[model samples]
Target: MPLPTDTYRALTQSVSAELASLRASTPDVMKAFGDLGRAAMADGALDKKTKELIALALGVAAHCDPCIAFHTQALAKLGATRQEIDETLGVTVYMGGGPSAMYAASAIKAFDEAAGATRG
Candidate 1:
């Protein structure tokens, strides 16, 4: 399904709330997972923006709608241009094959939606 412009923010907010609840319920596990994600995405060899694009490509490769939405918004917020996103999608399509191509399209739709959101 094509991603609606509002869906990205809604999904992210919903997920954030759910995750916060889960963190309270399973503090140890959630903390570990959250810490790991933060650590992996932190600036080091690659900047945060690069990591976000890598993550966005990974989201497409994995065919995770929520991940695509989340990463699309993150990439936009980090100032990724269309060219960079297209390049990342190219690699994603190459690595992930036919299925990834479909998801990559979805990712693009989500990215456009996210970009629109920031404008207004």
Candidate 2:
């Protein structure tokens, strides 16, 4: 099932604040992390959209709720379709097993809710 829209919205807001605090409190570390993330997601052998999907799958495998929400929102903004997400979830489930399957569902729910929030 998809996450409640309000919950997804709250998670996004909370994460933004947390990330901001991390940047303020640990500028050096956060800058390094941010630079690596930017480089990793930049176009090359794998495009930005594909990297986002991979990140989403990893988030599911790791059972990180905030990561899931953040990546899902990024994927949506990058024009990822439902079909692509479904296929990515299939691979994530296969590689990560039963627990990942459950988290994949949660990721999808969060994505749907986030997408709605964006539209509104």
Candidate 3:
């Protein structure tokens, strides 16, 4: 099933609030992240697919459920296959050991749901 609009909205708002708070408390960190993001975007060596995969890996490493879900959808929209997504999550499992397994599963489900919408 598609995630409810309210759920999506709340997730977006919460993430925004958290990011805003982080920016306020650690402006340098936010600036650094922004710079790194820009640099990554500028690097033509990594295609959009590879970049989303990298983002997925980071989301898994950070244990951010919302980020995982969001990036999963983004990757799916970019035409990443289910197998590719699973493989990416497997990498996360290898890096994060055990606790990340569940998060990866959840992310996969989120990706599937998002993909379903686009297919239909």
Candidate 4:
């Protein structure tokens, strides 16, 4: 729920480890992933709102709970409303089916708790 700074750092470190492993095994693949990440961040056709929505959907599709939670928090910091988050998850459900629905709900709960902590 309430994600502490340690938890966030740990999650990011774990993801970094995974990426490092992938880079060791397939440098080209890792390069592509880096390229894509850079491209996503670059100002282009998709604005911040669209990019965050896409990130949320991808996080759901990948079933990465940490990613989902993190992005939801990020979106909220960017002033995304509860309704928007709910609708994004709904779209995730449409794309990823039932399992994604469950994960999305969990992600939402985690995000809500984390956001509440910041508010207090």
Q: All candidates' lDDT scores?
A: 0.87, 0.87, 0.76, 0.74
Model 2, position 60: C-alpha lDDT score: 95
lDDT of 4 by residue, 19-54 (tens): 787799999988998899878856588778678878
Q: Which candidate do you rate higher for lDDT, 2 or 4?
A: 2
Better of 2 and 3 by lDDT: 2
Alpha-carbon shift of residue 16 in model 4 (angstroms):
5.9
Best-performing candidate as measured by TM-score? 2
Clashing pairs for predicted structure model 1, backbone only: none
Clashing pairs in model 2? Answer: 2-109
What does candidate 2's lDDT look like per residue over 1-120, in tens digits? 444345765787888886898799999999999999999999999999999999999999998888898899998888888888989999999999999999988888878876786677
RMSD each, Å: 2.1, 2.6, 4.2, 4.3
- Higher-ranked by TM-score: 1 or 4: 1
The list of candidate 2 runs beyond 4 A from truth reads 1-6
TM-score of each candidate?
0.88, 0.88, 0.70, 0.67
Write down the worst ten-residue block by lDDT for model 2: 1-10
The local distance difference test score of model 3 is 0.76
lDDT, candidate 1, equals 0.87
Clashing pairs in 3: none
